[model samples]
Target: MLKIGEVARRTGVSVRALRYYEEQGLLTPDRTPSGQRRYPEETVEVVLLFQRFYAAGLSSRAIAALLPCVNKGHPSTPQRHMLRTERDRLAARVEEMADTLHRLDQLITDADRRAGAAA
Candidate 1:
């Protein structure tokens, strides 16, 4: 068992964020007699996984559903599907961003050349 602070230190997450995660039903920490929250060692990995998936645009509800599969020490087919779907969506978005960036770069280069020719 680890205290909330310990979990935060080990996981590089804020204690407040951990408490919020608990409130969101993402994590369940045991309360000590003195009211300090205790977490299992596995929680560090769980929280980090949550962070990565969330950054990848996974919703909290989706992550909540997926956590059970991970906690049980089993892979989830549904979560895998979701991840693949998310990957496709992100790839599409990245392609769009790349196109936009390419257009912007071309505009900047053209403007620079025009300015040099004028000079």
Candidate 2:
């Protein structure tokens, strides 16, 4: 067993975030003898999952709706298909960000070159 602080450190997440996750029902840590929070070993994996889904642009309510936060199969085929579509959307967003970054870099370089030539 580990304390919530330890879990947060191991997961590279903040204690407040972990508590929020718990409050959101995505994470359920047990209480210690003194009412402190204690997490099981598998909690590390769960926290990583939460981090990934969050980074993938999922809101708490959206993640709670999709992930279920429990160890069970999904409800129906539609849910599965929806998850797949969301993943595809995330992939597209990644590509879009890369293109945007490239364009921004090109603009910066062009401006720098123009400034140097005018000087």
Best by lDDT: 1
Worst 10 residues of 2 by lDDT: 67-76
TM-score of 1: 0.71
Candidate 1: lDDT of 30? 91
Tens-digit lDDT track for model 2 on 1-119?
99998998899999999999989978777887799999999888888988998888888887777765235665467667768878899999999999999999999999999999999
Candidate 1, 1-119: lDDT as tens digits:
99999999998999998998998899999988998899999899999998887887878887787777777756578877866687898899889999999999999999999999999
Model 2, residue 85: C-alpha shift (Å): 2.4
lDDT scores for all predictions? 0.87, 0.85
Clashes of each: 0, 0
Q: What is the C-alpha RMSD of each candidate to the true structure, in Å?
A: 2.8, 2.8
